[model samples]
Target chain A: MRIGELSRRTGVPVPTIKYYLREGLVPHGERTSPNQARYDEAHVHRVRLVRALTEVGGLSIAAARDVLALMHEPGRGRLGSIGKVHFAVQAARQPHTDEPSESSVARTNDLIEQRGWHVRPTNPARAALAGVLDYFTRLGQPDVLGLLDDYADAAEKLAVAEIDTLGGRDVDHMAEHVVMMTVLGGALLNALRGLAQESAASAKMT
Target chain B: MRIGELSRRTGVPVPTIKYYLREGLVPHGERTSPNQARYDEAHVHRVRLVRALTEVGGLSIAAARDVLALMHEPGRGRLGSIGKVHFAVQAARQPHTDEPSESSVARTNDLIEQRGWHVRPTNPARAALAGVLDYFTRLGQPDVLGLLDDYADAAEKLAVAEIDTLGGRDVDHMAEHVVMMTVLGGALLNALRGLAQESAASAKMT
Candidate 1:
């Protein structure tokens, strides 16, 4: 397919596709002649994935690039690729925490230890969790702290299911699945929560 | 205390506080004289909530203003306020959906009916969920659709607990709590899921 056909099929503009080509987000199509390149089925899939991450998942261009890198990795073993993809996606979503609170850090460590989950203290999620707790502590909202265990329990159930689903995908497709699950999964959870709250609130208040 | 003390206590800058005052996100402090105003403890607390909504919750200034308006409503009953806060907070977070898919909307309505969840199709969350489902439909990833029930169960549990907590707070505090829970709760849930996924991925992959 020519770039225009690719654009028409995928609903992305030709200029945007060209920009993605320059950014290496999508691979260069085979050149049939000067100013004419042919994109294949794989290119269509890649373009769709890139669009999903950027437009719907709200990942930045650089973050989407990092995610795309996972899908293209050729040298690593399956588990190694999984670990790397997970780390990259988590790191991309995590806020930079240069000044983490020691108390929140201690609490996060304790939660990890208490759960006996195989997560490292240096994991970006730990820092992200600690940051939220630190914000709560600063805001004097101690009551909100009590909900952590419940939230973790729910997260664990979903996380386990998410990891289990990854086992069924082909190695080539695993990175995209993980990226989508990690990023869009948050959106899904939030939307579900909104619906549920409406239900609960209606049941209680009405 | 004066504005400077409020700034120092909340760690928000005096100029930002002034901006909040001008924006009416925070109530105007009583003027002591022509050039000086007296701020009390309430100002300090309001500043913290405003910062929390903007910085951690990632709400826009206008969204934050809507949330503050909920907190300031004086005549509405508790249940009415709860309903309003829920609507406003959901409205603020909902992504603009221009051309919603009919199938996804049907699925969202079916899911709501299946669960007997008291959510309207017109609710912002219903649109948000429909949008996500529509994205999945376009991407041809129907497998992700299977996880909705699990996500909803967790959300229902959390939402019930959330509304229960709201029952204990005064009417003014209820709005702040709802906004914080709706917005910051998302940050918290995302962070926790990140940690849980790390744990799950490690256990499975390692």
Candidate 2:
């Protein structure tokens, strides 16, 4: 595929694709000639992933670049698998299924504890959500860190919900059923609470 | 109190306070002399409110100015109450005790019906969280539009577990708990879901 074909498939403009290429965010295409470059499926997928990360996941270009780098890391060993999970879940959502067996949970638990610790806290949001790691330890499940890493990637450091309680950490996937309910739920709760406060303030004034 | 005192109490920077005053985001302090002005507790509170609405609520200065204008609008009756709810909920949050009575619920229902419309879909976020809303509606009661306008808040929107979904509009204070739970719960669920997804995806690829 050429640049136009790639553009047609991904809905990203040719200029924007050039921009991503220039930024080194997108991989270089095969050279067809001195002036032309040949693109492929990898280019298509890469653009889609980039678009989702920046637009849907609401990550900055720099953040999206870092996340892509993390995803592209070697996946041969346990570390690779862990890295893949970190990359995918941070951007794409996993739909729910039935409950897992004790053994599956155990493997997930172990994988989370072992390789997950490699993800250092990049921001206070992840740092705050790191609090949940202790809770997971108590529950005999250490995978919360991996989940938190994934979350930190997707949610962009909503850790201030733990601190000042005024920061915006709205979930990225309002498309997912679980996420939407939570957003609406927050909205409704926030509304009634305000109504109640207003009533109280007026009562006092009266 | 001088602007410095207001700054000390509200923790807003002196420069920002001067900006707010000059921008008319805050009323000009009473001039004590050619260069001196005095503010009061009311000024301090208003500044804090303005900051909360602008910073946390993510409203532009012009937008915040417009919202504050509605807040100061006297004798708008129920519209006045709606503005109060709008501002209060947007400023992070606060807890409340006085639940709406059956009468209040009925009043809201009548007002919503009379408006010949549902909730004005206040936030642009609705398009994102539609999936969660579908999930919630499928489980039981499906009156989100009715309740959304009745609440007209971001934080008040929420998700209840299948077992705990609020059944009726008339339940006093029920909306607050449900909505708060929804936002916080959604955040938690998204975090967990992100984990589940990462775990599942890693297992397959690695």
Best by DockQ: 1
Model 2 stretches astray by more than 4 angstroms: A75-206, B50-126, B129-206
- TM-score of each prediction: 0.88, 0.46
Write the residue-wise lDDT of candidate 2 on A4-83 in tens digits. Answer: 99999777789999999998889999998998999998888678656645544435687667656655555423343433
For model 1, how does the per-residue alpha-carbon lDDT over B139-186 read when each residue is reduced to its tens digit? 666677788888888898898887777676776566667777887677
iRMS values for every prediction: 1.9, 14.7
Task: Identify the leading candidate in terms of lDDT.
Answer: 1
- Residue B95 miss distance in model 2 (angstroms): 28
> Per-residue CA lDDT of candidate 2, range B95-171, in tens?
21122245434554454355332343342222223322332343222433434443332222221121123233223
DockQ of 1: 0.57
Clashes of each: 0, 24
TM-score (chain B only), all candidates:
0.92, 0.47
Error of 2 at B8 (Å): 3.3
